[model samples]
Every structure is written in C-alpha cells, then in structure tokens.
Target: MGHIIDISHHQDPTKMNYDKLSAQLDLVIVRTQYGSRVIDKHYKTHHREFQKRGIPTAAYAWVRGISLNDMKVEAIDFYQRTKEFNPTFWFLDVEEESMKDMRAGVSAYVRALRNCGAKKVGIYVGHHLYKKFNLNLNEVDAIWIPHYGKNNGQVTSQPSFPCDIHQYTDKGRLEGYSGYLDLNRLMGTKPLEFFTGKEVVKVDKKDEIKKDKPSDWAKEAWEWAKKEGFLDGTRPKEPVTREELAVVLQRLVKKLG
Candidate 1:
C-alpha cells in the first residue's frame, strides 16, 4: 500500500514536488479551512495539483466553533468552498475544546454537512479526546484518530480505540517535501473504496435468492412454514444460515412439545 498524507498552509505548496509526491501517495487530504473565518490559503492549489496528477484527494476543515450555530456555519462554508474540488470525503478536524458541549456541537456540524449533500463525511479527533468528548460515533461515516508515538516520523504506536483511519505520525518525511508531514494509515476492515466512493459490496451467491418466487415443489412447504411462523416468507431460494436453521428447528420442537 502507498502512503496517505495531509497538507495545509504549513506545508508550503510551492516547494512540493508534485511528480514525486504523486508517485508515492495512495491519497492526499488537503485542508480546506479553519472553521468559517480563516480559509487555508494553499488549499485550492494543493487540490488542483494533486488532482492534476490523478491522485485521489480529500478535504478537511478544522472545527473551531463555540456554538451550534457556529458549527453549522462552518460546515456550510467548508462544503461550499471545497465542493467544487470534489473531495472523496469531507472531514471535521476536532482537536481543541472550542465549545462547552462538544458532543452537541460536533453533531450539529456533521448534520450540516449531511444537509449540504455531502455523501461521505468523516471526523479526525485527537486520540486523547476520544473518550473525553464522548461524541456520537454513529453520526459520521468514518473516524480518524491521531496518536503520534515518538514523533520521529515512524509509526511507533496505534490508537487504542476502534477507528477507520489512523494518523500514526505528524513528523513524517516524504521525498516530495522538505518539511515534516502528517502521515495516515487505513485501519480495520475498510478498503480504500470506502473512502473513494467506489466500494462495491460483494454478496455471496449462497446468501442471494435465485428467483423472486419459490420453486413449485417447495411453494406449499414455504407457505406452510411462513404460516407457522417458522420462516419469514422471504428469500425462498436462499440458503439458510446455521443460526436460522437452529431457530427453525427449535420452533418445530416447541410446537411438537
């Protein structure tokens, strides 16, 4: 697998070697803005450059709102500004405690993004605040947690929580840039398609029903099973799982008893 790096105004865009950088990257996450007020100056340039090289790109905005309204405003601004770039995912970077009730504020921000027609939204949280904020994890499509260990450009430790992506180090060095960079790795079972909006869920043939209706020979039995509440009357041609079989057997035994 290639590398995933995030860059902002700090990582001077002019000095970056696009050709070399594009060769080594699986994806690039560019900062769009810091809340609603301060936009990242180099965001557009970074997006254009990375996209020119056919590299997959995503965008993130640092959340800095103190109120629910502020969070919504920031979300709208972030989406409006970066939507033209067509980022694979829009991420909210929540680090500092900008609001007293972070859970409510962050939830508002995520909802705002959803209203803005963003199909894929993710959040990046400081590892330390993972348990402290207690934000609703189900609201977002993915979670990215940062736990830089040793900070020597190598991934020394992983985050303790379950996350979709992990930012292993902030001092990471790559050939395309002179300064340090934030490096991330895909964690758990999520594939790259999950982030890129190209995921094709594979269904097992055994799990799928061959036809909409049951075969003539089994139609009567299927109807009887459904009438008896032993089966759900769906997917008549599908193979039953062991658990389902056990449940049906138990129901039969109970009826006989």
Candidate 2:
C-alpha cells in the first residue's frame, strides 16, 4: 500500500534530505544500535530529522550475543537508548552472527525485549538465513525479509514466505540520496496504529456514569460496544479470556461492516 525504506549509517544522512525523502517515502526504519553498547552514529540524527519533517519512522537494533544473558543485556541497552525515539515498530536484526543457537537465541532476544516493555517487536532476516536456521517466525509481531534476486540486489525472485515488509532491492536511487539505497515494499495496507499505539481520544463523562464503570474515558466506548452486540452477555466486572476477546473482536468487525 505504501513505499517504505530502510537506512543506517551505511547510507550517508548528510547527503539525504529528510524533507525530500519524506515527501517521496511513506515510512522509514533506521538502525538504532548494534549489540548492547554501540549506537549507530546516524540514528539520533535520522530520528530527529525525520520527525521534524513529519515523516513516520521506526527503528531496528542489531542483535548480538553468544548466550541468553548476553541477549538480555543487549535488549536492555536497546530499550534504554531507542525507547526515547518511540519508534512505530522495533525490530531485532537477526543475521548470521546473532543466530548461533538459532531458535533459542531468537526466543531469548524476543523474550528480553518483551520483558523490557518494547512494543511491536519484529524480526528482520534474509530468506536463506531463515531457512538455514529454521527460525520460529511466530515469535515476533512482524517479519521483514531481505531477498535480492538471483544476482546481488537484482530482485528477480519473490521471497518464499509471507512477510509484512520485504526489502526488495539495495540498489535503489532516490532524490536527495547520494548513491544506491535499500528499498522496501509494504505488502498490505496497515494504519500507523498497526505499529504505534493508538491515540487516546477524550470522551465526556455524563450523568450515566456507573459505580463499576471501566474508566471515565472508556465508559462511552464500553457502552457503544455493549449496545452493538460486541460484548458477551456477562457483567462488566467479569474477566475476559483470550478466546472470548477474539470472538468479541470478530463480532465487532461484522457489526462495523
């Protein structure tokens, strides 16, 4: 649905105009850090400039570690540094060096990130590397695949797996960019909320507020949901299971339709 691009220090930020690029691209993912301590030199600059130009941005941290504890350290460091930027999506760059134990390593990194309260965590890997490691792709919120064509950067063949974003070519040329740049394609349409948390909307508190009301702000939403048959017939105080929540969502979609 939209044109997306990924960049790091490898591409010179000094040469790229954030305003022009923002006009041309829908989204951007910048490299924030590597391992635990090494921050990308251009990360803060890119993040700030992109935001100034009103461009939506996300970030990825390169995963580095030999063990689970090492991965946890890297996750903590990553969360501390990039949490300030508040990327629309946070991804762990999983490449050959980080895939030592393969499945367990990936699991450890994802778990550490979740523990650190990172939202919308995703994985970035190549097709060959994914198949080689037999990665459990379900561990993250989204999958980013980098598969160039038969030759390097040609983009002749399609990736064999379902992916949310595909890095199709590394030989892309964009205005304001000095040389070739990495290009990505967003496969399906998703709102910015799919990556970022939804915006909080303020609602009025009227005389109809009840003693066991959810939240003063959520009361209106709850009443609408209940009236539309999106809720089970249970009382509002009852807890919802994962299964019940799913059914409610399905019904809400049909109601909206």
Candidate 3:
C-alpha cells in the first residue's frame, strides 16, 4: 500500500521529526495528551503539527483508569479537547493490565466517545489483553488489534465482531518518526454509517478489507489463498508491499465479493 503510517508522541524527539513525516504519510494517527492524573502526557507538537497537515488524520486518547461515575468528568477531560480535530476516527488505548474496573471503564469511555460525535470510536488492545478479557466484543463498535508476532501470526477472525484494524508491530521505524510507533492496517467495518450515523462513501483500499484471515478459514480456503498468493507472512511498516496487497486483493475479490 502507498503512504500507510501511524504516529505517537511516545517516540524519542532525537529520532523523529513531525514536519518531515507529514510530507510522506497519507494518513497519520496523532496521539493526544490526557488531562487526567491516570493518563500519560503525549507530545503537544505532534498534535499541533498533525492538525496543520493536509492529510486525513485520526486521534487516540489514553483511556486508563476511567469509570462510569466520571463519565461527564472523564468525557470533558479526556475527549472534549480533541474535538478541535474533526477526526474521521478516534481510538482508546487499552494497554493496561491492572484490571481495575476495566469493564465499566471501557464501556463508559466507548459510550462517551460515541455520544461525543466521533464518526468511529475504536478500541485498541494487545493480544494478551484481548484474550484475557474474552469479553463479548459484539457490544463494542470496532476493534484495533495489536499483535507483534515475529513469525507474523494472524489474530482471531470473529465473524460478527469483525476487527477494524491490526497493529502488526509496535517497534516500527519510519521516515519522519524518531522512535518506535505502531504500524497498523485499516480493516473493514463496512456500512460505516450504521455505527457512525454517516453516509456510505467509497471505501479506501485499506478499508475495503475482508474478514477472512488464513487462520479463520477452512483448511482448504487458507491453503488456496496462500497457494494462489493471498495471505503472505510479512511484517507491516510505513509503506506495505503493493505486490502483497495485490495478491490479497485478488483473493478477497473472489472470497469476499
């Protein structure tokens, strides 16, 4: 794919430059600072500079230690400030293992975000947290899965609760970024209007994905895709291999369409 990228302030300033990055990436997710005691502060320049860019952008918030009672307070403190960014998507970073009121906290954050006019409120969690929760994901609008398998393993393929994106690695180095940042793919959640109350527009190539994963299919389908050149085991970075993309698209056009 062309110009695929991710952004987070957690990188070393000595390593990454925002303006230089804006020149390359077509889409970037700028991490926002949390105005709370429990959250970590992100780079302010990252936020300012991403907004200045002409690219399609989204934002993420650190949603640690949130609760239902603090819905108003949390909503105001956490997400309200990000409204300045008319984000096409928003993500809640669920990297905690503390398990302190995790369910209520997650539900409240998701609900509050939905109520906040976000076109899509995304939940991001690593594979461990995901399996631990084993929570009925059908309730959540969409999922952002983070799996950095050196061998490049695919995550689960739930038919109903189809994931929206996959973070193939957390140790990615890119053009403008100075430190390791997430490298993700925009997976499918078609009829985006259902949850977002928006209209059906043409889907971007990254978004026109099928729910079929090699690990999710029958033994034959999986093999056929691979033999026919669909699911190649490769790590993701700023720019994906178009050759691989073409193979996946060819397979999906038949399997998905």
Candidate 4:
C-alpha cells in the first residue's frame, strides 16, 4: 500500500514544498526526456528535489520513434541520460503512433535499454496501445498503465494486467502544488528500495548495473532452449523476426514440457 506520483516539466518543483509533499508520497517517477534530442526542462530539478527529501525516485523517457532504427537511437539517447540518475526503475513512455512498425519499434526500444545496462526497465502504456501493438510485455520488468475517470481523481475502469503501478488520475490535487498532478498506486508489496536499485547489497552505485537475475521460470526456459540447441550459441545484438521468435517459443515450450 504505497502512493506514488509522476511529474514532468508541467509540475513546478520550486512552487511545491517538497518537505510537505514527501510525507504524502513514497516514490516519484520523473520524466527525463522526450525522444532522442529534447531533454525535459524540469527533469534534473525534480530529480534533485525528490532525492534531497529522501524520497525514492525512478525515471521515464517519452519515446517518439518513427521506425525501428529511430527507436533504437532514441533508446540509446534515453539510456545515456537516465543511466546517470541511478533510478531504482526506468520506464519507456509509449504513446501516439510515432513508430512505423509498432511491434518492432517497441521491441527495439526495450532491448536497447537492456543492452545499455538498465537494471529495471519498464513500459508505460495505455490499454489500447497495449493491445494494438500486441506487445510481448514479458520482455520488460514492469508495466505502468494509465486509466482516468470522469470525476475528480477516480478510476472507473481498472487495468487488466496485475500492474506494478497504475496512474489512476491526472486531476489529482495536492496541498503543496497549485496544479493537478498525476497520481499512482503501487500494487505490489515490494517497498521503495525494491524500485530504487538499492536492495542489492554489494553493487556500487556508480557502476553500470545489470538487470536482476532471471526468474526461475525464465531460467528453466533458458536451460531448455540451450539443451535443445534453440539458441544457436550466439547472443544477437540485433532484433529477431516474429517467425523466428515463434519457432523458438514453440521449441522451448515443447522442450520444457
């Protein structure tokens, strides 16, 4: 049972008394960039302010990719900006029809972040885009879905996935800020440290962080794939086709069974 908030350049950190707001929130996700070139004006301000108050922080990059190659480039740019922040989590903000091939574009973006050593990469998407892209969400660590209601900060239709976080309202009123803010709830029991990349004891804060070790299911699938020669003894730094993916999945399933 935790409360979280997302802020962009729209939310003025200087105007809001963070000391007062910190009491009401456990974590903050700041918007760091919009695509490859444009940096969000308020990102550094909000990030520093939130950390100054000892609130856990993460980051999201608003993606605008016109094609798979474009998305990969944008992702690399995003990774460079956010990697310095050492946020417990990082998310790709997916909206609009910017990507020409939605599936390949999205997949490339996620893979790029992983390659950049983002330990806890996630996706921020609405239900419509989720289904439209038929996104293979298992590739990422978290899913943040947004659903707002007609009334003040109330959510009418809940997201279908057991979301790690839900942005329930955009019209939320807070005491320290004059304008409405995006409000979220963390659905899982993992505490703020879990999201902040601080849970691991041995890692140095400044070093390039790798994603947490794979889950038992993922390990099993990997072992099965390797045993059956499905991986072909190479790790590709490039994207794989859907047909190739289907064959691998089918082979892994049969081997596991």
* Highest lDDT model number: 1
lDDT of 4 by residue, 51-156 (tens): 8888888999898999888988988888787776678888989887786667778889999888888888888987677778777678988888887756377665
Task: After superposing candidate 3 on the true structure, give the runs of residues whose Cα lies further than 4 Å from its correct spot.
Answer: 12-15, 38-44, 97-101, 151-162, 189-257
How well does each candidate superpose onto the true structure, as a TM-score? 0.77, 0.71, 0.60, 0.72
Candidate 2 global TM-score: 0.71
User: Between candidates 3 and 4, which one is better according to TM-score?
Assistant: 4
Worst-scoring 10-residue span by lDDT in model 3: 151-160
lDDT of 3 by residue, 19-74 (tens): 78768665666666443454434535555665576656667766555456554355
> How many clashes show up in model 4?
2
The better candidate by TM-score, 2 or 3, is: 2
Model 3 residue 211 distance off true place after TM-score fit, in angstroms: 38
In model 3, state the lDDT of residue 174: 64
Summed backbone clashes in each candidate are: 0, 1, 2, 2
lDDT of every predicted structure (CA atoms): 0.91, 0.78, 0.60, 0.79
Candidate 4 deviant stretches above 4 angstroms: 188-193, 198-257
Residue range 1-257, candidate 1, lDDT tens digits? 78999999998888999999889988999999987889999999999998999888999999999999999999999999999999999999999999999999999999999999998899999898989999898989999999888978888988999999999988998998988999999999989877865557898775465566898999899899999999988878778899999999999999999
Instruction: State model 3's lDDT.
Output: 0.60
Q: Model 2 off-target regions past 4 Å?
A: 150-155, 188-193, 196-257
Candidate 2: tens digits of C-alpha lDDT, residues 91-181: 9888866646867887887888888888788899868788787768787888888877753544565778888787888887777777788
